[model samples]
Target: MKTTRLAAVAIIANLAFATGTLAQDKELGEAVTIELNAVKSNEGGCTLTFLVANGHASQIEKVVYETVLFDSAGQVDRLTLFDFGTLPPGRPRVRQFSVPGIACDALSQVLINGAHTCEAPDLTDGACETGLILKTRTKIEVTG
Candidate 1:
């Protein structure tokens, strides 16, 4: 019984080590850049097409982010999630998001609320908001 228990402990330890190293090897990368082209009024509100392009060498599986939209009076109308699932490396993936009850022109500012999960290491502190940048088209930055 003791022998079996010891063997089980050893196996569990090895598995843990392997998994930790694998995560470390993959290496969590940085957040990608967001390109906001144009916002058009849609059925109920407005639709904005944006591109999630690679900002680094690592492959990105998912990007969980939040967006804050300010109305014409600079008041926050709504906050929504912008999850870019499985971004292709070295290729630009265009994604669309619809904001209900909000006009395209009514938006005064759009900010990246937070970076919930980005890259391999996951949960990067302020990586989605403060570290955010607009490479093209939309000049609105992700700050604060």
Candidate 2:
């Protein structure tokens, strides 16, 4: 009987997550806006630039995100943690990621990873990533 109850609880949790009833989508991702800043490729490697803005009243320490880079042949994902030092409540900053040996042509798509790093100033809550607002300035595709 106990096992069945446990299973039922687990299923309900999953259902809640799938329905966006949790605070993950609604309360989070309100502090910052994420955008594609640029993408460069060369012998060195592929560089991806991103802009993160803090729209709330609290200063954020860093913006950590996961990115999925779909290349010509496969996909590459990375959890990028950038220390913005301090976003000062309403400022935006650009963070860069450089991956050697990967060219721009190989990149087919770019997706932002989930959940916030939750790093923030002492006076504010740490769920900065949850409060961030995500945006796309340009498509993550490369042209010859």
Candidate 3:
């Protein structure tokens, strides 16, 4: 009877730990939303102007943009990384990045990966800043 009780306790403890880990993973997996306005297709590739507003919490420090371009078939054709600098609390910023080798006709969607790396600001010593990861999905229309 004692052995059975011990086993049950161990199982319960393991389950608690597993639940906590899963929650953390889910938070990290949540996608960030990015709005791309006025996307134009040129002769060579495409140009996109985007803005991120209230995309993160005040605790967030640095965000890294991992962009993946997909074709109409839903196959990933290009992957690009844009490192966005530090973000201040409650401040909105706009940035632009060009996508090369992407044809307007073949373009389907753009995936933005936002990775939050919250650390102490080099200029000032402070407490731990929370980090965030965001992924945005946007559709594109081809115009000849």
**For this target, which candidate reaches the highest TM-score against the unseen true structure?**
1
29-121 per-residue lDDT for model 1 (tens digits): 454566675567898798887765654545566777777888778788888888877665445566788888877878777877676776644
16 Cα displacement, candidate 3 (Å) = 47
lDDT of 2 at 73: 60
Cα TM-score of candidate 3: 0.52
Task: Mark the 10 consecutive residues where model 3 has the least summed lDDT.
Answer: 123-132
| TM-score for each candidate, following the candidate numbering | 0.65, 0.60, 0.52
User: Which is the leading candidate under lDDT?
Assistant: 1
lDDT (C-alpha, whole model) for all candidates = 0.63, 0.57, 0.51
lDDT of 2 by residue, 15-125 (tens): 444333222333434455665656778576887766556666666655555556666665654334444445655555566778776777677666555544556655455
Full ranking by lDDT? 1, 2, 3
lDDT comparing candidate 3 with the true structure = 0.51
Would you give me the overall lDDT of model 2?
A: 0.57
